[model samples]
Target: MLLCPYNILHKAERRKLLHAIGRCLFSSWDSPVYFSDVVLADIFTSFAQVVGDVWLSLCMLLPGHSILKPHTGVGSRWILPTVMSLPYLIRLRQCVIEYNHQGNTHRRPLYNALKYASAFPAIYLSAAQGMVVGEGGAAATWFGGSHIFRLWLLAGMVNSLYSFWWDVTNDWGLDLLRPRSEAKKSESLRSPPRRLVLPGLHSATPHILQGSSSIDVHDPEGISRSVVELSVRKRCHALGLRHSLHFPLLVYPFVIFLNLVLRLTWSMKLFSVVNVNSHAGIANFCLKMAELFRRWMWVFIRVEWEMIKKSRESHTKHRADDGIDEYELIPSATIERTPN
Candidate 1:
C-alpha cells in the first residue's frame, strides 16, 4: 500500500495535503491568514466592492450625471472603503470573541479596535481618488486641459487597484487565527529547533544564543529575551517561531510599495486638483492605517527580540554556576585592577 501514491499515504500526510490544497485555494480568493493579513485583504475587497456599489448607485440616482463633469466636485469616495471595512471589521471582532473566551480581554478588545481603525484609511484613500478625479474636471473647466483630468483618473484607478491587491494578499495577522493541523503539530514536535546568534547591545562578542530549553524557564525576566537569542538557545523548539518569511514577503512589501507609488504619484502632480475635504479625509485614513501597520510591526519585532534576550539571559544564569558574573556576557568600558 505504501507504493500507491494515493492510497498508501498515512492519515496525517493526507490531512496535510488536504490542508495545503485548502490554503492554496483560499489564498487565490481571500488573503492567506497571517497577522494583519485579513485586515489587508478586507481593505482591498471592501474598497472594490464599495466602489462598484457606488458606481451602480450613481448610475441609478443620476442617470444624466457624468462622472467627468466639472460641477460634481468629486462625489463621496469614503462610502466604498468605509462600507467594505465595516463587515470585515465585524468579522474580525467575531474572531476576537474566541480570544476573549480564552481570557485575553485586553488583546481581544485591542484587536477589535485596531481592525475597526484600519478601514478608515482605505475609505479615505478611496475618497481622495474620487475627489482628485472630480477636481481635475473642475481644473479642466478653468485651465482648458482635459488630458490632465484623464491622466489623474487613470492614475487613481491604477492606484486603487494596486491598493486592492495589497489588501487581498497581505494578511499576516490572519495566520495567527488559523489552527495548525495535527500533522503539522506532530511534524513540529518531531523536528529539531534551529539556533540563531545575535550581537549583544553593549558587547563586541556575539551575545545571543537561542535554542531549545534555553529560555523556557518560568521567570519573568527570562521572557524579555530576543527571539533570535531564544532560538539559538533552543527555547523556541516547541514554539515554532522560525517559519520562513514567505508570508510577509508575499503580502506586506507589495502593499508598502503600492502605497509608496500612490504617494509618489500624488507628489508628482504640480497642481492641487484634489478637493480639500476629500484629500483630508483620505490622508487621515492612510495615516491611521500606516499608524496601525507600524504599531503591529513594532509589537512583532519587540516580541521576537524579547524571546532572544531571554534565552541569552538564561545562558548567563547557567554560566554563573561555573563562576561567571552577569556582567561577563556584557562587557564594561572601565576595567578594575585586582589587588593581590
Candidate 2:
C-alpha cells in the first residue's frame, strides 16, 4: 500500500490503493486519501447499498428467512443511522482536528464542521422515528406528526439547503449566490486560486487578480494589457455565468439547476412519502441509485474545478517567470519530449 504512492504518481491510481486501506487510515498518510464531499458521501451510500445487496443475496440463498432480511429488526434501526452518518462524522472529526491544530479565528472550519454535524440530528432523528412501532408491527408515523418528526424535517431542510449552497459556492467553485456586480468583478473565469488543497483541509483562499491595470506591468512578450482583459471579458460574456465555465457555456447553469433539483429530491428520503426506514425495496434502491448518479455528476464537476484551478496557478507561475501571459492547452499526444 505504501509503495503505491511512491511508484504511482497519478491521483486515480493512488485512490484505488487507498480504497483498500479503509476509513481508519483516511487521514494517516502524508498525502491523505482525498475525501471530498462526493467521496465521503459515496462511502456511506455505496456501503449501504452493498450491505443491502449482501443481505438480499442471503435472502435469496435461504428463502422465507425473516432473520436474513436487511434493516428489518431493532438492531437495523441503529445500523441505518450509523451507516448514514458515518461519513459526515469522519469529516466532522477532521474539521475539529483542523480547528484544534489551527486556531478558529476565522471559524471557517468550525462552520464547515457544523455543516457536517447537522447531518447527525437529521439521520438519528429519522432513525428514532423507526423505533416507535405502529400497527401491524411497522414503524410509526412519529405519533401523527409529532415534535421529533418536525425537528427531523427541519434539520433535513437546513442540511440540504446549506449543503447545496456549499456545493455550488465552495465545492464547485461557483459564487452563484453573490450579488451580480461582485460576481462579475470576481468572475470565476478570471480569478483562479494560487494553490490547491483538499476539501475540509482549508477554506477557499481566492487569489484575486489585482485589476486590469497590473496587466501592463507584467506584459513582456508584446502581448498588450488589453489582450488579457479582452480575453477574460470575451470568455465571461460568452459563458454568461459566474463560475469556472470551463465546459460549454450552457453547462454551468444546467449543472447548477440539476444539482439543486437532485439535492431536493435526495432530501425527500426524510419525508413520509419516501420510506427511508425500509432498506429493501424498489423505492429504496431507486433512491440510492439517484443519489449515486447525482454524486457521480458532482465528482465530475468538482474534479474539473480543481484541475482548472491548478492549471491557472501553473499558468500564473509560468507567466511570472517566463513573461508569457497566454498559452494554449495542447493535446498530450502532440507534445514531443527532449531526450535525456
Candidate 3:
C-alpha cells in the first residue's frame, strides 16, 4: 500500500516537473526571441511603407517629372493621396496575416501598424511639399510668386501651428474629460492641489470689483479644475494647429529659398538648367536621403532594443535579489529535495 502511494506521488511530481520545464522554455522563446523578431519586423515594415509611400506620392504628384504617369489628367491630384495610401493598407493586411499565423495575445505588430498609420498624413504632407516645391515645376508660376498662393500658404501655416498647440494642450490637459475606462479618473481626483496662485491685483475676484457693491465670485479651484477638464478636449485641436503651421512656416519658406538659390545658380532659368548630369545628381541625392531615413530607422530600433535589454536586466536582478527562483515557486517537498 505504501509503495502504491509513493508511485502515484512520483508520477504526479514528474508531471509537475515536466510542466515547469515546458513553461520555462516557452517563456524564454516567447519573450526575447519572439520579441526581437516582432521588433525587427515592425522597424523594417514601417520604414519600407513610409519610404515607399513617399516615393509613390512623389511619382503621382510630379508625373511629368517622374516615373508615374496617369493617362487621365481629370483626377490627377487624387492619385498621389490614393497611391501613397497603399503601403499603409498593405502593412495592415500583413499585420492581420501575422496575427492570424502567430495566434499570440501580444499586440506588438498591431500597435506598430496603427502608430505608423497615424503618422501617414504628416508624412504625406512632408513628401508632397518635397515634390511640389523642391522640384521646380510648370505650376511654379502659381505657387512661386502668386499673392493668392502666399495667402493660402500663410493660412495653412497658421492652422498647422494652432492645431499642434491645441493637440499638446489636450494631450496634457483635463483628465476628467477622457473616457472613464482609459482615463484614470481616480488618480486625477487624488492629485495634490497646486499651490501656485495667479498674480494680479484682483486675483481673488472672478469679476474684478470695478465699482461699489460689486461682488467677487472667484472659485479658487476653478482654473485647476478647468485645466483638468480641458486636457482631453484640446488634444487633437492643439496637435492639428501645430502640425498645420509646420508646412507654411518652415517647409514652404525653405522650398522658396531653395528655388531662389537654384534659380540664381542657373541664371534664373531653373527649369531649363536640367541636364543628364543634373538628373544623375538628383537621383543620387534621393538615394542618399532614402539611406539616411533607413539609418534613422535602425537607430530607433537599436534604442528600443537597448531599452528592452535594460528593462529585462533590471527585472532579472530584482528577481535574483528577492530570492525568487522558478524552482522555489512550487512548495513541493520533491522540488525542495532536488539539486539546485
Show pairs that collide, candidate 2: none
TM-score of each: 0.29, 0.62, 0.28
Give residue 219's lDDT in candidate 2 (0 to 100).
Answer: 40
What TM-score does model 3 achieve against the real structure? 0.28
**Model number with the top lDDT:** 2
* Candidate 1 lDDT, 1-340, residue by residue in tens: 3234565559666665555434432443223333333334333333333343454456446756655432332344444444444544444544444344544454544444454444444444444455545555445453333544455455455544543333222222222213456434533443333232232443444333433343333444555665444355243223333333323433444544544554434322211222322335576456446544643553454344445445556755565474322233221212234334
- Name the Cα RMSD for model 1: 15.8
Q: CA lDDT of each candidate?
A: 0.41, 0.57, 0.38
Compared with the true structure, what per-residue lDDT tens digits does model 2 show for residues 232-312? 745655454442455765677878888788777676563322133355478766877777777778887788878867766
- The reply for model 2, stretches above 4 Å from the true place, is 1-15, 19-26, 29-76, 97-107, 133-145, 179-240, 270-280, 322-340
lDDT of 3 by residue, 63-99 (tens): 3654433233334444544554554455454555455
lDDT of 3: 0.38
Ordered from best to worst TM-score, the candidate numbers read: 2, 1, 3
| Per-structure clash totals for the candidates | 46, 0, 28
Residues forming the 10-long window of minimal summed lDDT in candidate 1: 267-276
